[model samples]
Target: MARKPGALRNGAPFRDWVLPAAMEKVRKRLKTVDDGDRQMVTILGCVPGDGITAVEAACQEALD
Candidate 1:
């Protein structure tokens, strides 16, 4: 079946802000939950992964 425009099919594009958007929440959370002075680091060798939607959903859940 043909996928929708934003469908997470093979080769579908994920946004540039996916990681940054997620990390922004993490930064705020860390400030409240952990040491406010500590910095968080994430390493992504690839730009877009197969599970981008799941990650986005998780970030949204964290913000809520």
Candidate 2:
């Protein structure tokens, strides 16, 4: 059978490609740690639009 555009036979392409790429970039931007540095990591996500911006700002503040 023929498949539709952006339609995967199984699972989600965005989850495999887009999310991983974005996360890799985020990880690369993270600061290095020393023995005294904490190793805590937090992730915040929200739906597109103003909600996402708000969540991102909150994450930045928390991370900072």
Candidate 3:
């Protein structure tokens, strides 16, 4: 996902990975930006270390 952010949209590996509501919302919003894919991938990459809950909270904070 970090290397090929575009795959996050239709990649088989991420087919079953459901994002948190806020994260998903942020992701959809990011899709509109020119480098959104890369930006989202960077955010997603933080999940392994920061955890989904933390990332989700951050996404929510960002949205707010």
Candidate 4:
């Protein structure tokens, strides 16, 4: 299968404290998710009109 351009290996950007923090956020969101609802997660890279760091942080927080 082909990989997404913005995708990083093993979520390297979110390291150390950031990783744990992100995981907690994702877990909390997951708890409230509706049953049978497909979760769509995307990690945005350094692109125009997007912050690579911020997007990574958000995705890490929501899906990483």
Best by lDDT: 3
> Which parts of model 2 are misplaced by more than 4 Å?
1-14, 17-50
Report the C-alpha lDDT of model 4 over 1-64, residue by residue, as the tens digit.
0243222223455323333455346534654665211231332223235664575566575463
- Model 3 / residue 23 / CA error / Å: 0.2
* Per-residue alpha-carbon lDDT of candidate 1 for residues 5-64, written as tens digits (9 for 90 to 100): 222112235423445577457545654544332233221212256365665565568678
In model 4, pairs of residues that clash are none
lDDT (CA) per prediction: 0.43, 0.37, 0.89, 0.40
Taking all chains together, each candidate's TM-score versus the true structure is 0.32, 0.29, 0.85, 0.27
Q: Candidate 3: misplaced stretches above 4 Å? A: none
- Write the number of the candidate with greater TM-score, choosing between 1 and 4: 1
lDDT tens readout by residue for model 3, 1-64: 6677889878898778888999999988998998898998999889999999999999999999
Q: Model 2, 1-64: lDDT tens per residue?
A: 1223223213375345443344344434543433111121333224244464565555456546
Q: Which number leads on TM-score?
A: 3
For candidate 3, list the clashing residue pairs, or say none.
none
Error of 4 at 13 (Å): 26
Q: What is the lDDT of residue 4 in candidate 4?
A: 33
Clashes of each: 0, 0, 0, 0
